[model samples]
Target: MADSTVKNTYVKQQITDAMLNLLRTNELKAISISHLVAAAEVSRISFYRNYTEKEDVLREYINTLILGWHVEYENSDKKSEEEMLGSLFAHFSKHGDFYLLLSQRNLFHLLKEVLKTLYGPKPEYPNFGAYVAAYFSYGLFGWIEEWFARGMQESAEDITILLKNRK
Candidate 1:
């Protein structure tokens, strides 16, 4: 039983590495199952066994990345609001290419899901906490897109300062 779980983990890691490599050199739209299979050095059957489609692979990758951030935020008692924002910005900056590609309107829904998981369930329509979470997630995504498009000229410190000063 444990052996199968370990093997599955290994195969998933291979697929993730292949996807990251392909993403680095090509647009997301350009990546196909054949390319991913070839890069992973795995058969089509292997790829299919793990993922239903390329979109599934991408969804898994993004969710895993965001979940890790959520876990860090949840576990840490010392992270101030500024530190949390800085950490989020730093993460997006490190994976700017991935975020830029995943910054479409549809992807914001995924961000919203992550927000719900991180912040817990929203209240009624006028709930301030819910509103803030939605605004922060959506706005932060837009901010990341603009930063990447501009070649990320600002340092992380500068960006962190900007976030800190926001009302």
Candidate 2:
């Protein structure tokens, strides 16, 4: 029983890793069950045993990423607002291709849901503060996209400085 459980876990991880790799090279829409199974070196039956569809795998992947981020931040000492923003930006920057793929329309909605789960409900800010936070998140995503587009021209520190100084 233990061995079977271990095998199941390994298979799931393999599928997840395969999907991530495909996302790195292709748009999310281009990923299919056949491609995932082939990449994972598993049969279609094995893939279905773990996930019903590609979106299921992608949902699980996003959830895992968000949960991992939550744990990392939860374990750390208090961080300033700037530090928090920088850390979040750094996380997305590290996964540049993944973020780029996820920044698309449908996937970005899912990303926002994951962010809400990780960070809780958006804070209540008065007037312009709310607009600022919204723009901050949008701008942060834009900056990361620009980095990936330009082959990461500036360092994360430079981007963080730019974000901080944005009026």
Candidate 3:
């Protein structure tokens, strides 16, 4: 089990670097497993040993980020929602390039799940939490994608402030 864990870590690290480097030039759809293995200098068996698909690589990376957000939230002062979001954006912007690459993947489901976890059970809405989760997840991701497309023209705080000011 320890050996498998170590191997997985090594394979994942290699694949993550290869994918990110490839992302600088190639779209995710364009990057085949063969290309990834070659760039990562890992065997096909090794790749499959750690991940079933290329998208799994991205999923694991995002899981780390979302977990980090949860940790930050727990450590943070219980302030207004805007402040927490602004802080989260600041962290997101800190790793802007990786996130820009990440944004291309269809992470809507992931975001929706996380938002649902964050917001929990809100009985105030007539449609239950599904509608609210979808609205927040899609809207928030769309907003960030636009911000990223603009080359993150404004600071994270500015972006969050814009959202906060929205009527």
Candidate 4:
């Protein structure tokens, strides 16, 4: 089972990478599974085993990339908010290309949902409410999108520091 899981992850990454490479010069609609199979150098059977279509590969890749960090946040030992946010930034920096393409494709609806996971732990303060979570959900995502647009020039550590100091 573990071997299957590993192989599945490896093949899926290959397919997703191929799709991104294709997206460099072609729109999503213009790229077919055959193109992906050829580009990835994987068999059509391998592609079908991992994904139903080119978009599925990209969508799954983005969803996994976003959700994995939130899961880590939820499961981690107690840590400072800066450290947690820095971890998230580190993940984003590691997968900068994926996020960059997702941004260009305007495929960020799932990002808000992923960020909404942070709302699960509500506080008792007057300023802490669903409204505040909603505000952060939207505002933070917009800020992040803009940050990516500015070329992500800051290191993850620097980003964490800036965000921590931001009013």
Candidate 5:
């Protein structure tokens, strides 16, 4: 069981790496499964076993990054809104290159999709709480989208300061 989990993780990592590398020079639409599998050094069977489509690889990678951020945020002992904002900006800044690439490729929607998955309205939430969650998520996503559109000129710290001051 452990071996199977390890193998799956390895394959997924390979696919994610290959997809990111390919997206560096190639449009996502231009990338084919054969090319992706060959670049990943994994067989088609392995690719199919891990993912159904090329976009899935990117989505999975984005999800992993977001989940990583979530874990860090949860464990950081952030007690203030400013600290939380700092953590958020820092994480996004750390991966600015990949995010920028996604923006350039018109694939920022993938990030938005992941954010929706994380913060979208939930069945468990009351009606008001669900709308509030969706509202906050969409608003936060809009800010990030604008930052990317602006070429990310401001440093992460600068962003944290700006938002912190706005409150």
Candidate 6:
């Protein structure tokens, strides 16, 4: 990798780690740019150059996670809804600390925004496929949010079974 690319990645990672740490104990709206930069050990300019706002850091991290999961999902033999959901639950379970923090902080809505971006019913489009995709995304998000709410106590297989048996 180029020098600048490596530096930029380092800066972004620093900011992301700082944001997550802050979100653990502080409210999202309460954290200021000054506090974030101080916690991140990066300059304000660095933060602004890489991210427009605080939420962008969290959004980018979530996007990275979803992208990783997408790659795994693509590679796995997850042809059915049960298989796909089982994979998803396992992924979230592995990252339970980060996700549990988001749940505690009431930040799961950001996941919905990221999902919409990836599978959108674009505001201008009038198509059944778009609506179907959007509906599916929303429904999946509902399951994820509820799973987080329940402290993710159940095993992924158990949750998949529950979803399969839902009336």
- By TM-score, highest first, what's the ranking? 5, 6, 3, 1, 2, 4
Which digits, one per residue and each the tens of the lDDT, describe model 5 over residues 82-156?
787788778889999999999999999999999888888889999999999898778778878899999988988
Summing lDDT over every window of 10 consecutive residues in candidate 1, give the lowest-scoring window. 104-113
Q: Which ten residues in a row have the lowest lDDT in candidate 3?
A: 106-115
lDDT for residue 114 in candidate 1, whole number 0-100: 58
Lowest lDDT 10-residue stretch of candidate 6: 117-126
Tell me the spans in candidate 4 whose CA falls farther than 4 Å from its real position. 1-11, 37-53, 67-78, 108-110, 117-128
Each model's lDDT: 0.73, 0.72, 0.77, 0.75, 0.89, 0.88
Residue pairs of candidate 1 with colliding backbone atoms: none
**Which of candidates 4 and 5 is the stronger one according to lDDT?**
5
Which parts of model 2 have CA positions greater than 4 angstroms off?
24-26, 100-110, 120-151
Give Cα distance to truth, residue 69, candidate 1, Å. 2.4
The candidate that achieves the highest TM-score relative to the unseen native structure? 5
lDDT of 2 by residue, 5-83 (tens): 9998889989988987887778777887888889998889988887777878878887887678767876888487667
TM-score result, candidate 3: 0.81
Better candidate by TM-score, 1 or 4: 1
List TM-score per model, in order: 0.75, 0.68, 0.81, 0.67, 0.92, 0.91
Please give, for residues 8-98, the per-residue lDDT of candidate 6 as tens digits.
9999999999998999889999999999999999999999999898889988999999889989898987789789888888888888999
* Model 2 local distance difference test score: 0.72
Q: Give per-residue CA lDDT, model 1, range 1-167, as digits (tens).
A: 99989988888889888987877667667888898988998788888998897777777887888878778776878478788877877777777667665553234345445545554435664687677877766677566657766667887678889878887
Candidate 4 C-alpha error for residue 8, in Å = 4.8
- Give candidate 6 misplaced runs (Cα > 4 Å): 122-126
Q: Tens digit of lDDT per residue, candidate 4, span 62-112? A: 678777877887788838877877888888898887787767766655455
